[model samples]
Target: MSKIGQAISEIQTLENISREDRWVNRLHPLGKLVLTVFYITVTVSFPKYELAGLAGMLLYPLAVFTVADLSFGDALRRLRVVLPLVMIMGILNPFFDREILLTIGRVPISGGVISMLTLMVKAVLTVLAGYLLIATTPMDEICRAMRVIHIPKIFVIVVLLIYRYVTVFLSEARRITQAYELRAPKQRGVHYKVWGSLLGQMLLRSMDRANDIYESMQLRGFDGNFRLGKKAALRPADFLWPVLWALVILALRLFPVVELIGRIFV
Candidate 1:
């Protein structure tokens, strides 16, 4: 399949995963959303050179992946895009921070090298935390969770619209690509010279598609408020998971859990 087709398929697969009868999907969206936010915050709060503590933070994603029964291979494949961006973000850290942090046997390890590794680990774990939420919770459920917590009505609606539009725009672009490929069968992907015109045309097509989608929504009486399927009650028991995980996360963040564990082993 073409790259564009593969991209569309990946998106659909993610949507399917969210709707699957997985363990994580079985939980209350609010619980998952809240804990996800807390987890990311804790992960990001670590100091750049605190690599050991940051390494221990991998427990969150590992726990999520194990509970959710998500595929590790698929997770790594998805990381390809993020890996480049993360490297670019931290590539210069080594040069900027040349402080001799410590000596490993003979060679000195600088603060920049340590911090760069820390930043990259933080980036991977944070991204994984987010996708774990998406893997288990549908976009609508997330939006509903936000509303339940008293987010502004207009903002909720806007979020839903943007999420819906992504699929619509992707569909429009895919169709355009197919037509271009049919006309220029010899070319591999869109030519560089045509990128500007192709994107401009895509913009026009997207706007028209958006208008059609809006009209359809209006015809279906889609008021600013979304009406989702009758969600099961978010029970008191539902709060247990997030609360427990959050406590563990907080403790790890405030205290040196990694060092304590290492001391015990040593």
Candidate 2:
């Protein structure tokens, strides 16, 4: 498939996953959002040399995947493009921080190496937590959770519209590409000479479509304020999920859980 088509499919797949009738998907969005934020904050708060403590943070995403029956391999695959960039953020750390902090036998490990690994772990855990949240929670529910937290209405509306219309924008681009391909058969890709004209046409088409969408919204009584249906009352599970996870996360953070476990066996 073309790259654009693959992009569209990925978005649809995420939407489908969120809509699945799984227990995790059914949990209240606000609780998931809270836990995700808390998990990320704790993960990033660890000391640069405290790799063992940060290692314990992996439990959160692992539990979610197991409970939700999500494919860990698939998640990693979908995130392949992003993981490299995140990993590279700390590549220079090893060069800048060369203090010897510890040794295994005769071999010495520098502070730079530990900190670099620590940073990479932090990046992976936080990114996975975010992906899990989005994979399980629909965009509407996410925005609703934002509203519950008192996020500005304008910001919420902008987020919702951008997500909702992105597919439309991509679809238009795909149509233009296909038409161009038909006219210029045997070309490997779009010619540089036509790039500007193609983009101009896409912009014009997208603007017209946006105006029509806005008019439709007006006819349907879309005021400046976006409205969601009456909020659902919070359930017991909604309260329990975040509380339970928070305690586990805090215990891991405050104690040397990984090191203690290693002592039991060694």
Q: Write the per-residue lDDT of candidate 1 for residues 206-247, one digit (tens) a residue.
A: 788779888998999977767767979777667888998998
Candidate 1 vs. true structure, TM-score: 0.87
- Candidate 2 residue pairs in backbone clash: none
Of candidate 2, the 10-residue stretch with the lowest lDDT total is 74-83
Q: In model 2, how large is the Cα lDDT of residue 2?
A: 83
lDDT score of residue 224 within candidate 2: 86
State in Å the error of residue 145, model 2: 0.7
The number of the candidate with the highest TM-score is 2
Q: Can you write out model 2's per-residue Cα lDDT over 124-166, one digit (the tens) per residue?
A: 8887898899899999999999998999999999999999988
> lDDT, candidate 2, residue 91?
77
RMSD vs true structure, all candidates? 2.7, 2.1
Candidate 2 ranges with C-alpha deviation above 4 Å: 181-192
